[model samples]
Target: MKRVLFSAPSVRRLLLAALACLSSPAPASDRIQIVTEELPPYNMTEDGRLTGMSTEVVQAVLEEVGVQANIQSMPWARAYDIALNSENVLIYSIARTRQREQLFKWVGIVAPMRWHLYSLPQRNIQLRRLDDARRYQIATVKQDAGEQHLLARGFAIGKNLQSSNKYAHNYEKLTLGRVDLWIANELNARYLARRAGAEVPVPVLSLPDLADDDGLSMAFSLQTSDALVERFRQGLKTVRDNGTYATIAKRWL
Candidate 1:
């Protein structure tokens, strides 16, 4: 015959406890922040929103697993630097290197690339070995994998002619003889040649496997909790096992 509520002091205490728990981040959740560059066919913006093959793939995987994360677009160097120091931030589409092999926890393969060296017509330098690069100055976009790969291999590269406009100006550097050779991805070189109305080599030279570097994946922050990394890894395996990853890959590639 009577309905009574908890005492005022008791109710107040309960509310405060609940609020504290809600405010605290999940043990596995580190408030993830992702930074990506404007590399086309991978990460780029459309109508001021982030959208591309790698971008879409990462967003989908995170959403499927119900993780709260944000992706930011910025210059490649800046993004990479920030990701290195910031907690829970990852630089997507990163290449694997001996120096970086054990640094970050990788999630899933996002994309693959077939790298090539492009030369302007009539000036194509022959390359049969990695040592062949030493004889000529190579061109690459700044802080790009190509740049890192070449420089690390002890080849002298031209000034960091790398930019988001890599495709547009790279050919000029080679054609005008600014640099001896330019390294480019197959798709990007073709895209640029078509837009510039210039001719790219009929057959791009393949540099013997500096690194496989295929399969783009999220690189979890070193500061990210192991539990979170493991969770994402598990989630990725689930997606892959179910063919969800392949399905998503087909949508873009």
Candidate 2:
């Protein structure tokens, strides 16, 4: 084989081309990361597959948008942090709140949810108002909308608020008398109680002040491009308009 050498200018051009290739960003679809937690009826891992109401809705939107992504299930806190700090990240079935309005680019609503303060019937807990419950310890998931809402209203961790990593843990705490109240969404509370082979806990107080009337939504990290976010928003709208959203909701809700 004959040895060949490039000219000085040619070598500089080649280096520049290589560096550009190395530094260029990946395609939007390739960089996108989808995450969720095991908040059932919305998102869950069953038989090694990720499936739920919101999961199905998200899948439908992905199909509508012609984007393919695998959903990963993890603890809510970890998932929330990843979505909050990472680029091109998508989190589904997250409650849309005023506190989180500027944190991420909104995609669209996934499901309706109502926050409530729950207690076992035997406990007979009564709450005439939000402040009335401050006397008792409340169970909440760390970084969850419920916890954030309560914290905003003066519920301090290790004081009157007991934070946990999982929603199931909160249920366990409430049933074992470790906590006086479990602040949660109505659908999630009912699902957890019934799945544990126990009677559904009583919704002692409706948290209208902290209610997320806009419902749960699929959101992309703030670093995502406006075009990509709009694609997902339109995809979600397509699913809702074409009845795919309702079909999924009817099956799960």
Candidate 3:
């Protein structure tokens, strides 16, 4: 084949076209927004950057799939809402409950936390099951998984459920007797308690009847593509197999 030499104007046009193609914005699907709450050791903002166990795992997953992550630190309620309505959005360290099973496409179960009802040791509270404790006032983080779980179980607000925006406030509420019981994750409760300088007394009730294996997964919006979700699933497995997951978990857990 004979080579055709380009004229000056043709060369300029070709160069400009190439430059435009190179500088064009990446497709929206190539970038994903990850929303997470400030739950210590799992997901939180440190020094103005998102970093935690779940965060690290998410980062590793994104790296494996070769996608960019735009992480946002927000309240759990707001993040949960965004994940429900937004496309190409991800919410990490969320409880995978039966009520939420069909709402989102799950990547993988990243962590497991035992749910519990905590109270002061001196109170001598007694509960054989979650229902028995329903008569007493319970403090929960607003829009948290525990709060949603309680609501699904018919725990009425203002009657038995007390809501707080911050997780630490629930601890304070429990300690001050503002609420009879505080519903929280086992690890998160201990972490927040130590941070708040509050003592969570013994005799805590494990909510096995409620959720024996409460899995925390990075859930994607329903609008997310199956291919994208599968990519993340494989990425998670890769990290776990390559020991990246364990390394990150050790640092935070």
Candidate 4:
């Protein structure tokens, strides 16, 4: 080929263009902030490391999509707020609700969760209906799906509802009799109860209205691009199809 060389001015222009590209913001997919809460068997920080069923599944999905993010575990309230106000932020194991349907772009469900009222066996707390829970003090993680669920059903904070930054705090309060009821998923309640080293097992009370089955999913901020959301959705399917989802669940479930 004949020699083709750029003029000095052309070379300068090319250099300037490369600098501009380097200084520009990252693409939406590369800016994702993935967040989760410390819930055993799902997501948690142990021995200064983050690992759990949901964490592994999320990692697998991101790998399938060729995306990477630091999966940080923070208080549920703070994590929830960050996912709500910031662009390119994703919160995992979030319960999908009608009220939140429009607030965020939801990925596929990660796991199934069922909420129940837990109390000490000797407490004899009778919870036949949802309203019945209102008569006693209840503890829940701040800004958690269970807390929102109760709030939507008219549970008042600082009165019948005691919100904590961590589920362990609520379990402690429940075991101490400071809170008459602990609102948590069946798996979480059992996990927290064991972790709390409770001498007596916390028994589940019947709450017909609150017994509905719910699911946890990765929810992206409304500001995230639709293409990125779809990528994650499809990546989740890939993991499930490849049996990675089952393998992760087996490790925890």
TM-score of each: 0.79, 0.88, 0.92, 0.87
- Write down the lDDT of every candidate, Cα atoms only: 0.70, 0.90, 0.84, 0.82
Q: Show the lowest summed lDDT stretch of 10 residues, model 1.
A: 156-165
> By how many angstroms RMSD does model 2 differ from the true structure?
4.9
lDDT of 1: 0.70
Worst 10 residues of 4 by lDDT: 206-215
Which candidate would rank higher by lDDT, 1 or 2? 2
Clashes of 3: 0
lDDT of 2 by residue, 31-62 (tens): 69999999987888899999988899999988
Residue runs of model 4 more than 4 Å from their true location after superposition? 1-26, 200-203, 206-213
For model 1, residues 119-180, the per-residue Cα lDDT tens digits are 77687467777666666666677676777787776654334333333544666777677767
Backbone clashes (count) for model 2: 0
Pairwise TM-score winner, candidates 1 and 3: 3
TM-score rank, highest first?
3, 2, 4, 1
TM-score of 2: 0.88
Give candidate 1's TM-score.
Answer: 0.79
lDDT of 4 by residue, 113-136 (tens): 777788888877766577777889
List runs of model 1 lying over 4 Å from the truth: 1-30, 157-177, 194-198, 201-204
Stretches of candidate 3 above 4 Å error? Answer: 1-9, 209-214
Error of 4 at 107 (Å): 0.6
Q: What lDDT is reached at residue 15 by model 1?
A: 99
